[model samples]
Target: MTGSLTAARAMAAAAARLRAAGVADPARDARLLLAHAARIDAARVTLIAPEELSPEIAERYEQLVSLRAIRVPVSHLTGEREFYGRRFKISGEVLDPRPETETLIEAALSEPFARVLDLGVGSGCILVTLLAERAQATGLGVDISEAACLQASANAVLHGVAERAEIRRSDWLSDVAGRFDLIVSNPPYIALDEMAGLDEEVRRHEPELALTDGGDGLGAYRRIADGVMRHLAPGGRLLVEIGPTQVAAVIALFAQAGLVDIGIVQDLDGRDRVIRARRG
Candidate 1:
């Protein structure tokens, strides 16, 4: 840092700092941060790996590395995340899309629907991806944050689904009208007590509104159970992403709300990650 440093040297130093900070994947993160700072593809980092970094790039790289060392998510630092075979823009205002959520997407797409509703849409990854996959399908995505709505809208445009997708600021389905043939949500399920134990990147950098419902982790599920029956058309399907351990509680809430045909889907890790239900 004091003297001129090559890309390889800088990457090594950054990785060392991240390791000391308890980052789980220090070396890989170091290369990714460097790639963003250098405005180069990660695959091409090796070409510059042995080359000296320009002063400006070096400074920016160091700043990004520092942020990453402090537990900022790489997706947030880069402002992009890949989900459902597409790249989505991300920010502190929305939850970063995770691969586990793809289980919900897979489950939703397993059935057919002309209209879809996404609750707590965040960056609109679910609605957008679904709309993209089913070109004729239309979708409405709702979130409580105006910023999240805006971000979701932008993502819809990015994926060329803006014409068929609508992003709105709402808590669940409060202001939504009409019934959707299919509805999905990846709501906040982390209990208030469990929040303190979240990874530093999630606890410190991600939006809390998208992370917890401020009481029981099941609060969002409860709210959804109350509203989904009214919003879903007869014989419609509903799928929700859930924490690995929330299967029983969520299924009970849905069943109590009169939802039937309820089932569970597992992620690749073999953990229960999505709950599937249907309204008669």
Candidate 2:
């Protein structure tokens, strides 16, 4: 923190500062931020541990740590997040891609589909990853927020899938046309009452529209269900990420929508994380 400070010493000080500020993984954050400040991969942090940081890098690290202490998300600070093995450019305008949503990705890739639709495509991780993995596939990704649509579009281009993926702004399926063999969503399922309970990073930094439906949390699902049948091809599939406690309600909603073969997929933590259904 002072003159001629080595990377190891600076990280130790930064970790202590983060720990005192209630960061959950202070050491990890310190290492990552140091790497970012030094313009090096995180894996190289250890190699530079004993070397003194340049005044410029040290100043940059100080600013990053200051923002992080206030609970700004690391992805926002780094300007990117990795989802489904791909890096996505992220901002406060969109929700950070989550690991649990990968459950939906796995369920989606379990079958073959030449066409896919992603609803509420906050960062386009789902649609873009699908197209990247399946070279023959093309997709449409829609979000109500224009900012989210732009974020998704950038990610699609970043992942080399922009040519095959279309990003648009639409409220659920309202502006969408054409049937698809697959549809996916990680909608705003958090209830209004639950907003205050979220972490500071999510509650303060991420977009509210990408986190909550401003109601009982089933609003997005209801909208999607109402229009799904009209947009789904025969035997097409629908996959959605959901909260652990939402299994019964989501299943019932899908069933009422006349979707059959409904089933759940759990995340690595074994929580009910995704619901998959097929058009009858």
The best candidate in terms of TM-score? 2
Q: What local distance difference test score does each model get?
A: 0.91, 0.92
In angstroms, how far off is 160's CA in candidate 2?
0.7
- Residue 32 in model 2: lDDT: 88
Give me candidate 2's TM-score against the actual structure.
0.98
lDDT of 1 by residue, 147-224 (tens): 999999999999999999988888787889999999999999998999999987789988999999999889999999
Model 2 misplacement above 4 A: none
* Backbone clash numbers for all candidates listed: 0, 0
Off by over 4 Å in 1: none
Report the Cα lDDT for candidate 1: 0.91
How well does candidate 1 match the true structure in TM-score terms?
0.95
Clashing pairs in 2: none
How do the residues 54-168 of candidate 2 rate in per-residue lDDT, one tens digit apiece? 9999999999999989988888999988888788899989889998888888999999999999999988989999999999999999999999899899988888899999998
List TM-score per model, in order.
0.95, 0.98
